[model samples]
Target: MKVTVFYSSDATKSAAFDVQPSDTVKSVKQKVIALHSPPDWANTALLAEKDSTEYFDNRKRLAQCGVVDGAVLKFTYARNLTLMEKVELNVQGTDTGNFQLPPMSISTLPPKVAAY
Candidate 1:
């Protein structure tokens, strides 16, 4: 079974590996974790999908999600940021001063409430 591990960070990359047909997603994740050591900020979290449909990580029914050849396993790094903090980020265009942004959603939380 050929599985692909996608690591999301400052950039994205795909890593392909061969495993047994009986291999589980959890096993595959362990292999990926060993291959690409993630930083402390990124605790190994996976979003296993095939053809745009996400596979549920029900540990009980591992075999339900068929593991065939050429199945794409995408590994993603979740951004640990508050909703308000995400909105404050500035986006810049290729050319110097071209900046575009969507309307910000004001937070009801008080300013004294610390944002990570």
Candidate 2:
């Protein structure tokens, strides 16, 4: 069985892995971490689908989590700060601040605005 994993930070980046129903989520997460090399503070979670918010438990097998062959799982991370966010903070010339901005999707921003 093959499973497609999509990175939450960058949907354009995805990887397909050959897996078995018996494979545990933790094992899959290890594979993904090896391939993507996410930040040290980042923790990976597997979402069953693109629109699904529910995540699978690391202790559960793929079969037990309702994952089937050819399923598309979204690989997401919980971290301190993303690279982009860090850059933005640095550009502001401050290590600590009380500014809060709404999350912006690259697709929604104008090409020129999104370019930076």
Candidate 3:
């Protein structure tokens, strides 16, 4: 049986797999990461075609999960946090609304400690 996996947010980020009825969801995720996914495959979730809210168990077999050939499995993974993103998360929330900030790139100019 053939199953297609794609990112829930972006359909363009997807991969197709030819799997057996006995294949586990965990194995499918392995291939998905190997092909062209973020390194965080363990966090990737497999959503069934019928219900977007429900997730397929990794230990369950394709046949047992009601997955069929041509079934579209939407997957979503957590993104890695950058230094600034991590810093923002550590910031405490107050009654004045959340202190939110966008990630940034920094550059500096050379210092003139002893200019004549």
Top TM-score hit? 2
lDDT of 3 by residue, 1-116 (tens): 88888854655776788999899888887787676556443444455653376778889888988888898887766554554655655664323334456644554865558967
Name model 2 segments beyond 4 Å from true: 43-47, 80-116
- How far off is residue 43 in model 2, in Å? 4.5
In the range 11-110, model 1's lDDT, one tens digit per residue, is: 3577888877666667777777787777778644565763444744726233467666776767664455444444454322223323444455676776
| lDDT minimum window of 10 residues, candidate 3 | 92-101
- Kindly state the number of residue pairs that clash in model 2: 0
Give the runs in model 1 whose Cα sits over 4 Å from its true position: 9-12, 50-55, 58-63, 79-116
Quote the positional error of residue 35 for candidate 2 in Å.
0.6
Off by over 4 Å in 3: 39-47, 79-116
Candidate 2's residue-wise lDDT over 6-114, tens digit each?
A: 8757668889999999999989988887887766776544555666988788899999988888998888777556566866876898674455655656565556645
Q: Rank the candidates by lDDT, best first.
A: 2, 3, 1
Query: How far off is residue 30 in model 2, in Å?
Result: 0.6
**TM-score: model 2 vs. ground truth:** 0.62
TM-score of each: 0.52, 0.62, 0.57
State each candidate's clash count: 0, 0, 0
